[model samples]
Target: MIGDRLKMLRKEKGLTMKEIGEIIGVSDAAWTKYEKNRAEPSIESLIKIADYFQVSLDFLLGRTNIREPQFVEEANIQSEFLKEFEWSKIGDPSQMYFLVENLSTSIRKYNEHKVTELELQLLLKTISDVVLYFNTLAELKEKYKSITKEVLTEHRKTLSQIIEDLNNILEEAYKDILDGKK
Candidate 1:
């Protein structure tokens, strides 16, 4: 999947393998191997490739067909009301993106016979729970407008702690999933 995307992107730019290799500081043969799926680039190299192409890591990894990052889309909002809203803070898009990548990895493992159906289901459930909790926290903050200032402040503090806890849970889950894969 990655190899195909790399080849396509390289061709789209009218770049030869050697040219791209020089740009990425890798040998032409190594670049060819990546395109052929015979070798995978290190995470550092992957970042370099994505950066050089001006594409998102998700797109380079074949996790999304969309070339633009979600944040880019968010930044293009034209409404003044929406522009004032810090949507990214309410639901940390970076965390969501990381979760998406983990889910994609789990699905791919399941498809490749690397993980059991039950494992995949558990991962899906964990992800669903995290999203539900995170969104609920966001909703509570926005929906409690009539509450006393003191109460609202306390709620906000509590909500922030809960969000942090949820984030820790997600990070641990992601580590567990990747560790299990290894």
Candidate 2:
């Protein structure tokens, strides 16, 4: 799906693969593979392409049909799982908490040359707001097995109003750090 979207966007702009690759600081072959879906781009490269095309990442990924970037739903969790959901010790929520907890540790290590800035940023956005919502839902599901669909729908709306995407979260975190709020 990404390959198809990438090819379409590239053609629409009348740019050759090589030209776009040069613009994005990637090799022509690498760009070709991306279009062919033979190779997966790194998250940074994905972000770069999304920004370059002025298209939302979800559109490129075929997760949504919309093209506007800001309106992109970074993640969508169906209120109902395909199968019966079960709580796990290594669930997404726990992993998200682990990631947040280790953020400071990563920064300390990076200052001491243990990790790179790339690693630090990746760690920070590892769990997007959508993921946080899903994990919260999962926790609630564990406790309220009989919750009605209406309640879940209302909860989704409430969460969406408050939580922003991982990108925004990173931006806020950076602001907090710079403003001595971290």
Residue range 1-182, candidate 1, lDDT tens digits? 99999999999999999999999989999999999999999899998998898888888888677787664454344234343444646665555556556766877888998766665665566556656666765776687665567556666765676566556546555676768864
The 10-residue segment of model 1 with minimum total lDDT is 74-83
Pairs in steric clash, model 2 = none
lDDT of 2: 0.72
- Sequence-dependent TM-score of model 1: 0.41
> Which lDDT tens digits does candidate 2 get at residues 42-148?
88998999999998888889988879876454223321221223244345564444554475577788899765566556555554544666777887788778787
In candidate 2, how many Å is residue 23 off?
1.0
Q: Scored by CA lDDT, what does every candidate get?
A: 0.75, 0.72
What C-alpha root-mean-square deviation, in Å, does candidate 2 show against the real structure? 16.6
Off by over 4 Å in 1: 70-182
